[model samples]
Target: MASKAGDDPDSLMSLCTIFCLKNLRRTMCYSEGEQNRLQLRPDVFLPGEICDRLVNEYMDLVHTDSDFEPQDGFFQLFSDPRSTRLTRLQLREDLVRDRDLEAIGKQDLMELHLTYCSRLTARGLRTLCSFRHSLLSLSLFGCSSVFFRKSGAPLAAGEDEDEEERLQRHTVDLDFSFQGFNRLRLLNLGGLRAELDVEKLLRPLPALTSLDLSSVHLPRPAFLTQWSERLASLVLYNVELTEELIHMLLQMSRLRHLDISRENQRTSKFKMTRKILSSIVQSLVDLVSLDISGHIMLDNCTVPAFEDAVGRPSIEPCKSSIYPFQELKRPLQFLGLYNTTLCNVTHIPAYKVLSFEPILRLLPQSSAPVSQHWATWALYNLVSVYCEYFTVKPSHQIRFHPKIMSFSV
Candidate 1:
């Protein structure tokens, strides 16, 4: 029995309800002249038809960006009769507060992302603990205000005295009561520099598989040891990879995605030699995404890997002193060498070589012009080299820059 086109869930979702502004640029809705004059108020409308479409069709209300910073504020946005069915919500760099979060708490949200919501404190976050059993993902990335005891938001002498007091109380609540996120699988605390007790934070999150501790202060590696068994994706970018951290990483047998990219200047040169690279390969058998970009390589000398892991032949780093090994079990899906040079990369393991998928993945969706520019160049080369067998994905079909196709021709 052939199902009708309307009966197909994929077809119906594509044809109706879900409205993604991601594919549609702001320029598509407003002219440059009108955009300049348009005051982007909280409750402002963007040409009646578009606004109507959003209200009528939205089922989940995923306004992921701060671009269309909800006309009626978050409260009114949730007040929509259709908003009762909402599950996932992502908001960034907004003046969203506890009162707004209270409204959001009413919904049975499964994935909540409140990135850089400076106005929000842990007091408001405690409201969403009711959804602890249901919620699977929560990213409070860059929302430093939640962790801090003080409000950085400039206020006159005696402005919102209650909220200031609340911030202090909630900061304490966050320390002990954050166990509500037990079912959470993905947690991103990137760029949050605060005095954090790493052990207490990870104690409740038993199900967490992907964690982004980028630019965070993870002094004790013992806290991360508990997560070694379940955690598959871990991003420790810009954090110091101490000797204990390296030893603990060697035990994470299930880890597939590891991003140890670091700042070139602040990070003392990490020695990434052939031996240490071999050790990583042998231990982390399931490792697929390895990002050791921007590090000081050794065995010879100078600048290297992940907040710069030191790999001196004379100095044994990890517990497994034995090296000159092979066997990945699987090829790495992505290898990030963003800031590394030929001089730095010497005796890296001869593991089947890298796939072009990483560069291909970067081209179409890259928000940065420089990334797109370099990715396009790399994509062309991959196409030229493997043009005989290369098959362009449908999503990547129209996104290729003109010069690459022209040059390839």
Candidate 2:
């Protein structure tokens, strides 16, 4: 069936406002069951079962240019207590400003996600405090301008700080408090280029579980020990990984996801050793996802000694040497090792690093030209010592080379 969106010039684009907004923060929300009887009958397609109140309550926003809703009319809508019952909203845009937050402040929202809204300042954060008591999840990634600067902010993430590396520090007087966030669980403050009081900010939220502190400075990550019993997942992308921080992370017995990927943008004083990697894999028994991308190391770091892991397959047919390692005891759903030396190593059974049959099957099945091309290369990379089981056929002819070759089903 065709969508009910009409023949208007902007037929393709439509807006929706629901109680639950899906993102990295899986916030819980409850509908208050309040209906605005004063709202005029809106012209909409036969609304679905739950659509009557949830959809029509905010549909007045559809007429954006004040053609349908006048200033007094908006005031009327705002004055009604029911209008302030919105629970979930994600307003992500460079154009979002402080005034928009002020308007939203009236509502006791449960979840709010705003990323890259650069125009927002400290005043906007003040408005956000209105929902501090009720909010369950909040993500303010890349919205650093909201903080007032003190000394220079955290350096551009490295062992050595350059003049341009300096980032602003948030002073104690930002007029914000985490004290009332009793129900808050998921918090993503990634890309906040400020020297945040890591301990003070987190000491209040006893319920916080999943946190993404990407690009944020944590000179004193001792807070990890405090939250060890509660914190479950963490993303520390581009943040410095010191030995102390590593030790603190190992204590989080409940931690499931850990992404310490450096992306090669900066330098970490600690080079990830095979020993350290093995220790992490062995200790963090509950870990479901682990990423160690871009930290420099020569030896095979992650996959330890086990037999259940599939045999390492290669595309180059060079079985001259195989770094023998056993399978990991636990199951990891995701493992990210991009931009690392392991980019070419395909022995990780946890991630199915480079299983032979999977890459071969993906070749013809991949319909897109780019996908087919990469699948062909993946096949090229899987030339095992035992090619007796598999036959190299060209869906088309190829100038095959002994060392490096092209492949087809």
Candidate 3:
């Protein structure tokens, strides 16, 4: 049967809501002994159901609250509140009622995303542990609900300084163990200010495959080594990267994607030098995607090491003996060098490093020139220098290297 264009998923979901309401009315009719007035409520697509008032409250919070600025109007598009025990619940700058928490404990929720819900206390977080066995994905990004202290506008000078001192003193001590999240696959603990003991938070979740610790206090590097083989994707944006941490990460050979992009423009004292880059390529052989771009301490010395790692032709020695590492174990898919010293296209050395050798490895064995390995290299800082490369476009290709490379604008 040819489905009409109007029978989209959104329409189908609406239809489901209607059917649930009808079912609820019919059930109410039978229970109330044919009462003229019938109350309608939604039914669960799976097993259990949620309160109608709670759904209305969530929708009202989304539309009226400024803090709950969803990425798009499509925030709650996929999961309808009317049905589905495993649903997406987003609450911001509002109190999580005890009844709601109780309801959540009863339902078989798979995903929960709570952001900036300042009124949700530590007790509420404890209550959330009820879903430890069921929840597959959980995000507590920007949620300062556990231990938030309110402050009034400064009436006197130096009051702001006093508040800062007070805030430091009252640092929330959030130490929830993740031992219960046995089935959790993806966890985002971004913007958490409390002390996160790696042993309790990370070691327990053996099934954890992806983690986002952006802007969160990092646990000891030694603790992360436990997940070296388990974790496939890790995001550490703006997290302080010490020399010890870099050395520890070298052992995570199973990591397929790693992002350590610095948020600040000023380079840190701990530079990501050639030695560090060489050690990374040598150690993290399974890495397919890596992002060490932005204002992290990147210098000229690191360029040659990257060129060698990605198999690009460089003025620097590319011989197996000089290079610390063998050919890259995993074909490099993405390289981010935006707003860094290595972004100079006018400079031959920078251009060579930016030439991206990973694309060459992905070239088809057949003689056909059309290639599928498209690599996106971000060079936002070097507009003039990048333009200069196009002037010598043909020079980029050679008879010796049949592999072709294409870059996204």
Tens digit of per-residue lDDT, candidate 2, span 202-285 = 678889999999878988887778778888889998888888888888888888888897745346766877667766766677
Task: Name the 10 consecutive residues with the lowest summed lDDT in model 1.
Answer: 400-409
- Give the C-alpha lDDT of model 1: 0.56
lDDT, candidates in the order shown = 0.56, 0.56, 0.53
lDDT of 1 by residue, 340-384 (tens): 542123223322222232354454454544433245446646665
Every model's Cα RMSD, please?
11.5, 12.0, 11.7
Report the Cα lDDT for candidate 2. Answer: 0.56
Assess every candidate by TM-score. 0.61, 0.62, 0.60
* Cα-based lDDT at residue 268, candidate 1: 56
Q: Model 3, which residues run further than 4 Å from truth? A: 1-7, 10-61, 64-84, 87-99, 147-175, 194-199, 301-327, 344-409
